[model samples]
Target: MGNIDKRNRLDEAPFRYAVTKTNTVFIDYEGKQIKVLKGKEAEKFLKRVNAADSEKELQLIMAKITGNFKRGNER
Candidate 1:
């Protein structure tokens, strides 16, 4: 209850941006955070990854709702 009541705390939701602090650059991925990126490369990389994940999830959900069935591709 105490942790939840911390009004000044900020949490990262899905696709939320997380700014890190360091003297150099970094490249962060799932299960990985390396200091090889330059400038805002890390942030761009994270945004791209998040967008890709969201796109994939949306595609899956859309397929399910639209009836994911396989048949001859007759157009």
Candidate 2:
């Protein structure tokens, strides 16, 4: 088997399931994995990822993407 085939069955299977079928989504940013909704939500999340300056920035971005923050915690 080739590298990809061998890697896919490795001890550490680095993957995550975002959505299914037409709404499916997957994100691997700087070696980290993220899953967000599709359509407009995905667009907004991508913008945040593009704007991230640090790992903290990315996490905050993800929190915003997932709507996990209260109004007081969002920027």
Q: Candidate 1 lDDT, tens digit per residue, 1-75? A: 233314312122211223457523333323244235435765555445556544444333222222311232311
Candidate 2 lDDT by residue in tens digits, 1-75: 233233232223223234457654565333555554688766665676678675545554554454433344322
Top candidate on TM-score is 2
Segments of candidate 1 deviating more than 4 angstroms:
1-19, 23-35, 54-75
Per-model TM against the reference: 0.24, 0.42
Per-model lDDT? 0.35, 0.48
For candidate 1, what is the TM-score?
A: 0.24
Q: Can you list the residue pairs that collide in candidate 2?
A: none
lDDT of 2: 0.48
